[model samples]
Target: MSAFEPRPPFYLGIDLGGTNIKSGVVEDSGRPLSSVSIETQADLGPVVGVENLAEAGRLAVQQSGLKWDQIAAVGLGSPGTMDLSRGMLLEPPNLPGWNQLPIRDLLAAKLDKPTILQNDANAAAFGEYWAGAGRNTRSLVLFTLGTGVGCGIISDERIIEGRHSHGGECGHIIIQMENGRRCACGAYGHLEAYASATALVKRAHELLAEQSTRSSLREIPAEELTSRAINEAADAGDGLARRLMRETSYYLAVGAVTLMHTIDPDIVLFGGGMIAAGSTFLEDIRQHIQKMAFPTVAKGCKIEYAELGGDAGFIGAAGCARAAFGR
Candidate 1:
């Protein structure tokens, strides 16, 4: 290819999760050309994570029926703070031992293209903004309520990365005062401590242990219990399970109301595995936020389910790459 020759039209996006690595080859229009997923095996360490990500990108490109030179750039969504300028993972808590990994340089060297790295939640927000639920909005906020509560905020079509790239960390926002529960971040009464899936399971187990009433949960060992099981039990009208979801929704509402007052986003989108519990889960959350939030702010903002689902991160990563490279 000549120096001045235009590259073929394609971009690569990757979502590096704690359990799985998802990737896609996408076009400028944000339509995915092809996609793939694989186990993250993050316990193998940062080097392995990098290698797995690069390999996933390569496989996605090949599966998309594109030549190497056809690709314009690569985008990555990782679960932590990142130096967007340097493309490095900075002290990620989810992936232990992944401190300051040179992600941009490594991927650039391997893929022979420019690379952009964004926090996973931020990427998801951008994805929703560009092609999903937030397409028509100028500002939006996204919450991923899975293993933990992850948050992303976008304003004026830009993902707001605060000083140190930790701006959209609504999960760590303290909502409770005295007698608040401890958060995984070692703080007291953080929203994530009560709103996250892990927290739901923790609360369910605590409830089960405290009450003498027989629960379907007793049939399964506590070690094997999960948030999904609790949701299912709630669907079956189990009193304890229903109460667990109600309380979880209430705590989540606190955070949602806090975000509404702080950001005044046009819309709030929710994603993650826990959302699969369906409209009941969403309605409960909406009811609480509507009851608690200021009428003016709440009236202007709409809460909706995320449309892009798992692909949000990958698409957003690709969008980030496009934004970074001026594509």
Candidate 2:
């Protein structure tokens, strides 16, 4: 019944992060032809950052040796809550002064092409579902473990963008009812509060400061400690680091269990910079999920690491563009 059957040959995808804006030209088949990253310079303000992102898209097209007119559409994945239908980024804290920015229209105007906008986490989930870990399942939830937990819900191969266009925020699910760790959203007992990579580093720092722990983390300056350093320490058989992994993985497991019951997804995929801990990091989450989730769903679901790594967000945005336009 629809006139558009197959989308054009190439789509442009952009990922807007706090530190960098990533851009890539994705073939209709979902393979990335080329990618580029540029400093966001949020310090210079949001307009400058948006301009930089647009320029990065151009550079990516140039790098790919393609003409701008060859691009069918441009898609963007950005952080923070947004009114997706309106294209307004509503009060994203990471990029100060980004309130009510009509990112979709701006990018479209600047790029001189039709553009689509979505949350970065949701974009990553789309990428994985279309081409990465969720390709087989098509029904999956994505948890991006970054500074905070970013949630993406795809049920029956459809992205669930709710009435307010803010429906699928899986990170805000409250796991703690009583006294719990404070979340970035100013709540307590959130999955993000306990399970995010930032939470892991914070928990490690607390354990280190609470008492002397015989681990490499103690030798490093407090500010120098990061999830990566902690993961490396754990890999080297450090006691405190191992314990930290155990504790954090338990929290991540709890979050996974929550996602399982809520989404009933065929697979629950984990992504973001911190999952670099690999199997050791995932083993704990899987073990806990096995014990806690419903028997059948637990057996059926796959607790897997996202295959796309850091590039999922942009790739997913391209996937969304293809889906939205057709083909």
Best by TM-score: 2
Q: Give the poorly placed runs of model 1, Cα more than 4 Å off.
A: 1-8
Models 1 onward score TM values of 0.92, 0.93
Q: Using lDDT as the measure, which candidate wins?
A: 1
Global lDDT of model 1: 0.87
Per-model CA lDDT versus the true structure: 0.87, 0.86
TM-score computed on alpha carbons, candidate 2: 0.93
Clash pairs of candidate 2?
Answer: none
Candidate 2, which segments miss by more than 4 Å at Cα? 1-8
Candidate 2: tens digits of C-alpha lDDT, residues 1-327: 243332348889999998999988888867787789999998798789889989989998898778888898888999876899888899887888888889899888999888899888889999999889988676899998888888888999888888877756877888888998899889889999998888999999889889775778888888889999999999999999999988888888888898889889999988888788889889888998999999999999999999988889889998888877744
Ten contiguous residues with the weakest lDDT in model 1: 1-10
Expressed as tens digits, the lDDT of each residue in 1-327 for candidate 1 is 664333446779999998899999878767887789988889999888888998899889888878877888888999876776677888887798888899778877887898888989999999999889998898999999898899999998899988787879998999898788899889998999898999999998888889988778878788888999999988998888889999988888888888888888999988888887889988998999999999998888999899999999999999898888843
The residue pairs in collision within model 1 are none
RMSD of 2: 3.8
